[model samples]
Target: MSLVGSNPTLSATVRWLRVHWGTGSQVKNRTIKWLLGLAWVTAGLYFADKGATYYRQGRTLPPSVINTIPEMPPHRAGDRVLVFAPHPDDEALGCAGVIQQAVQAGAQVWVVYMTSGDGFRLAVERQFRQSHPSPELHIQFGKMRQQEARRAMRLLGLADWRILFLGYPDRGLYPLWSSNWTPSNALRSYYTDTDTNPYRDTLHPGVTYCGQNVLRDVEQVLRRTVPTHVYVTHPADDHPDHAATALFVMSALARLRMQGIGFAQRVVLRHYMVHCGDWPQPQGLHEDEPLTPPPAFFNIGLHWVKLNLTPPQQVRKMNAIKAHTSQMLMMSRFLQSFVRQNELFIEQPVVLPIEASLGVVWEEPDEEDILRNLQAPGDFSAAELRMENGQAVFHINTRSKPRPGFSYSCTVHALLPNGDVTTTLLRTKPGRQSADARVDEDGVTFRLPALPSGSVLVLQAQSRFAGLAVDKTIGHVVRLP
Candidate 1:
């Protein structure tokens, strides 16, 4: 009767075994399994918690990172346009909805795939060492990715004629984009062969995707496509490849426009971002948002565009996104859920219809002094002195020389088209130009007072030369707006 009362239930026996023999490999394995399962569930729950928090905070439908709303079909209708896909997934990741909307709205949309995007799978090739270590796997995998991209586009309702693959292998894009082949520790490398690794096929003998060649090739595309409106990658994105592709597109557009192609009648350029973590958090910025625009931003919206994305069009876009199987497997589904909501753009309030103005343009050569809009007096030709909008950016090119026994006042003037100049925006002459503004080979740039909206404002440069002209080059004027 006593033995019958001690019948071992699974839970009771387990508890008894744990209490009696608490530590062993068998027991340890069970404990570890429980802990690991718990850890995984907790991690998943954390993401969900984050999503819930965002939703409650009213930023749920917003971009989890920098991205664009899907382009609607040709609701308003326009001429043919070409969409630039930096990699296999960029087209879907950035603007699948937009492409569907554009197509349905009656625009002839052409898709251009810039690279095969086979380099991202760094994990798969490592398996070769443990299994069959063949260098040929790299090319084989790359080819597979290209096929995946083609299949994805077809799912998005794109025909074969609408696609163009540059096939320019995409692994070392960052190095190529940042270098002019001047040969430095960073840019100089000897690639004899890739026979030892899985990425061997993807490696080339020369720099096929160098920035200059990229710019030239993309420019040719622009002329041939003749797209009235252009879409490219966001310059501020975290990915080097995406940013390089965007830079190429921007350079091409600017060159064409400078050559008299015009930014409006011929084309309009907009950017889209795919990298999630590094996306700008604009909400944290109350006013005068910090710009992530790398190198510089190109604006094309001095005009008007109005198109509404219908529900069906939005569904088509969502479906197109689902077609990217490999990518869909990798990215978060929550991000995909927000694809149809809103297509945001810079109002391009900077570039307006009445851009011509009687504004002052000033330029200075050295870094010692800052200037106002009036071209007070300086060296350099008006043509040689470059200006963007109405401001001149100063490049402290020479090794900066120190000036002693002189009191220099740093001032920033807000040039209003109404000719009202306000010097109140100057924070501190703290004599720390290095800490205050960002300067490089491109030029020095710092925030200026907002030029009152709808007016041509000018940025000026001036410096007080304290009784010496040889130690420092004096009397310089450079205007950048």
Candidate 2:
């Protein structure tokens, strides 16, 4: 009944083994066979581990790649620079070197923080030594972080007057960008328990926690400062707040362009990334290593740039990072990772008004896939906006058919020539489609209300499952012909 009797190859192998080992030494033969099997298994595991390491290395850009990127133009006298940060320490982490160089070069520098960074529960818990901190305590923590930012900027040679905090919710920026865009349905901060800006020193104290107010604040800042160079977070950052900050800043710039603000066209924009997957390798402090862009962004059409820092500049940058004591307490190593020989940035192209047809394609890099573990319900591959049959048509293409429990939505914010704002949205839920939207096997298409000529539309597409954003596209601005 043994399979060796029915299988010619197996029976021949068994007869050969017996002849080679001799049946009298059967015990020794068995021991040798066991040892051989163990060796093969061990070798297989070792090779697998090595292959995995090589795969990871392929996804991480080496530090020396910074040399290939062009150097950021040095700031000179009369140059006005504005740096926007999603949180207090972000400025120090990403732009401290730039701030120092600009200040030393006699350029005016201003730092605007979108949030107080009070929503971090772990930091508050550590600072207060409490498992459950109250809303008042969170507010107090925010104030403390603001002071830390001031000190950090001072260390980088910036004056107190040049620092501005908008005092918006730390973790609620995306909601403002997507859902709660109107003042009437303002979002409340989970930590501060407030539905409005509470910091008295902010530019617009008591401004509602809504998208419009956030955009308005950014526009006002741009009008007043009129920065020649603007630095903000990258849109593809892993953090939602960081991504939303970019969206809001870009939207404000788009609105300014619609209003015929010439400054918006003249200003230079650069995006810095602080959050990516295990970037700035060999984390912690490696001042000799240059900051390099993550490999996930290598093919994303970004013009990479670098700014090499002198030894003194690097030292000052480190000191400024330490000034963020609240954040250093929790992530000192991660913050210190930015104190490198050079800082990295992407030279953002000027926002131009898109006329007639607009098409945007989002190809997710393999390394940046957020849904690597879970089954991706769906992901955006491309989106287009055009006028069809005298109506505005928005189309989104997905990589695969959307699964049940997944939802997709598209929002368009139009700024009329008269300064009026009109918002339109179309969303499709599992097994249900909005009146304005048509969902098919490949993607979703939405029909928008007719927009007036000269109106600028900011469009965003997002996909979610279980109320969590899984994939999204950066805000695209288009002008009606």
Candidate 3:
């Protein structure tokens, strides 16, 4: 059988010729064979071209990306746990062990699927479009998927209700995000158990659209779940859906933090690799024994909670993956069919110093806004902000305590309204601990030139005293005068 897509022209002609060439078979058989050979060659080009286009257009992952395996950082079991699975099977592949371990340790666990992955529906539809690939046909497939999920959860020994499906079209997600595809087509009007319907106005008006509900649902899930921790798929995973899902979780976490509705006891965050590069070790990784200790992004730490896979739990995990049948036929080699004894994750802590984030709050707010906005008076030192133009404008005037043999420089990363960047380096002679750089009415004269105007600036101070690594890349962003 042809590996994929459409009937081969040679096969068609070969049958035709064999029947007609019975008597004259020897005379013209060689010619027919040669002609059919050309047809196969041309057909091969067509498939190759199609693959090239799909990848170049970013509809598919590149070979390198398709073969990547992800790593999770290390962390304690009692800490909050989060899992971002790109597709249904991904959770099983990347973080199942984490889930098992977290549950055992009484750590909260949450898994988010970025997309519903129904693209293969179309391919399946093509098999017998006239007879079997009907609206009901595709919907049945969905039911099959849900059933598979239930079966898998049982095997994994996971509490059934813990799983959630955002119901995005499986393969079409990348095209929707990076190309011209639309989420509504799949989320709102997919061939579900019922007829096509708008996502917001679904047959079951209560059944929310996957795209619209993902963010809001996740927000609610967070509040209700009250998870002390959050987990998501890797951000750099080659699969666009996986990356997008991780970014969305991060965004939700940011919003929740802003509302001050959640408790913070160092909610550690790290990525679980899945999808392209999420699995199938990258060239360097495979070549280098245990993979270049996963790039720091995936290298949270090696320590992980190991789950004792019971017979039922193992079956459930395997079944959960096998539930995604459409994908299995296409990539059975890569597809999961059995549960391994262990699941892995990274727990790399993205530690932003308090000052780095609160630099804005640390500012001396305009005495006017604070005085007017504040009904009660407290020491306003924490709320002051002084707005000005150029490098010299906002800098606090330096009370000089010249340091020996040291030099000071500041590179201001200013974000312009037009979305372009304007950088200006301000320099000064090194000052003692008690003497930080300063500014005044005359524009504080750092050792360098004046900076340009912009809405926000990320100031980097340097004199070769340090850089960031596992050791010391602390306090990168600083508020200027």
Candidate 4:
């Protein structure tokens, strides 16, 4: 009472509590209980409202976002569309909408899988219930995935004959692209334990698991289909197999172009990204949401296009994705994330030849933060190629200065008119000098044998630290002067 006399507001509060709860130890306990109850109810309502708002926002797509991307060109009756997938389920995840639309438009569509997705150990363990699956078991897993692919394609309105599997190693495409290009150095898959295509129905039965064979098979498919539009994975995809598929496809198209194949000239090339860092946000089935590119790709010089789907088309896509029972057992939510109101693709520009005299420059966006803590030095800032003093010269610039424990390399592919590809590799590491390569403060340069005129040259520059590739440039195709 004496304290309350000094503060009128405290006195009024005390009076109110005493009148309502009765003045005693029981009154204090009652007041505390009531306030605690009120807090619990208020917090429950607040969180419930927040959860509802988040759910709504996650499932809904704004018109502004949809309008920002250009619509994909429609497939017509005469169009021949070819889609290349790195794994079994990727076709359904990335291009089921396109396949359905093409079928509805009477366009001929073909789906080619680079691998049967045999290397996923978790899928193998779940499918066959084996912790240490043998090579034969992996082959069986592959065959099962092949059937799943066929069923999924059937759901997308593709006939069995229209689908082809290359049956290359599932996790070995990058090694083929990087180090194993000849039959002598063919890669052996750790999962399948085979250095050759084991599937009987592959495009080329018993082809060696080498880069040249991959290129040859892709070229064969391109020649046979002569597609007007080609869809493959993006070069910047986080998955090594996905990126290698794009490289093989492009190299084949370039070789075909050099051989006077006109399809390479007019074929429209689009890149679909399946694996990026934490992409396709709100990760489960959200049929009403629009699929968009990852934020890291926003300024990467890519022209993005989207294909809107009907409600029926979305349902069909969901069904196609579900056909991959093995994948569903492992990551159903990740697979279902692609079943949205639309699909996304990077509309690649027509491949153009760079004048050797003027040189060519390739610039890659800085994306070191995308994969945390795996910072390998030498993110490619710019790469230039030109002819100087009877030698082909390569000048590569990196984002940061040359550091210890890092190495830079340039691989040049001379696409001869006679259909032979001669590759030259030049590399330089910290405190090491090579005959053809020179490392500077912020870049590296290489001098190589001059390539003949009328031949095409493709250049790729890479940076490695601790034997791990941290960054690389896209294949830069150039013409000799």
lDDT of 2 by residue, 1-481 (tens): 0000022354576677667665566766785887699789889867865664456556677766776888878999999999999999899888998999999999999999999888887788889998778889888988999999999999998889999999899888878987888999899887788998888878888999998899889998999999999999987787879988887888788778777788887888889998876676767999988887888677666688899999999999999989989888888888899999989888765553544555334445445333443534456666667677657787877777777877888877877888887777778855787668877788778888777777777777778877766777656666677
Residue 254 alpha-carbon offset, candidate 3, angstroms: 0.8
Per-residue alpha-carbon lDDT of model 3 for 1-481, expressed as tens digits? Answer: 0013223354576687677676665748776788789889889867865654443333222334212444343345556555656556677666565666566666656665544443344445643454335555554554455455545555555665666665554443333322222234334333343322212311123433343345455566666666666666654454556655664455455445534554423456656655432233332111112212223222222333222345554555555666656656666555542244334444433322223223332322111221222211111122112433333222322223223343444444443334433445555433332132442232232332343332333332333222210010111122233
lDDT of each: 0.44, 0.80, 0.43, 0.81
**Ranking of candidates on lDDT, top first:** 4, 2, 1, 3
lDDT of 2: 0.80
TM-score of every model? Answer: 0.51, 0.83, 0.48, 0.82
Q: Which scores better on lDDT, 3 or 4?
A: 4
Better model by TM-score, 1 or 2? 2
Lowest summed lDDT across 10 adjacent residues in model 2 is found at 1-10
Find the 10 residues in a row with the least total lDDT in model 1.
293-302
Candidate 2 regions off by >4 Å? 1-58, 350-352, 355-377
- How many clashes in each candidate? 20, 0, 47, 0
Residue 46, model 2: Cα distance from true site in angstroms: 24
Candidate 3: worst 10 consecutive residues by lDDT?
Answer: 467-476
Steric clash pairs (candidate 4): none
**Cα shift from native, residue 388, model 1 (Å):** 13
> Candidate 4's C-alpha lDDT?
0.81
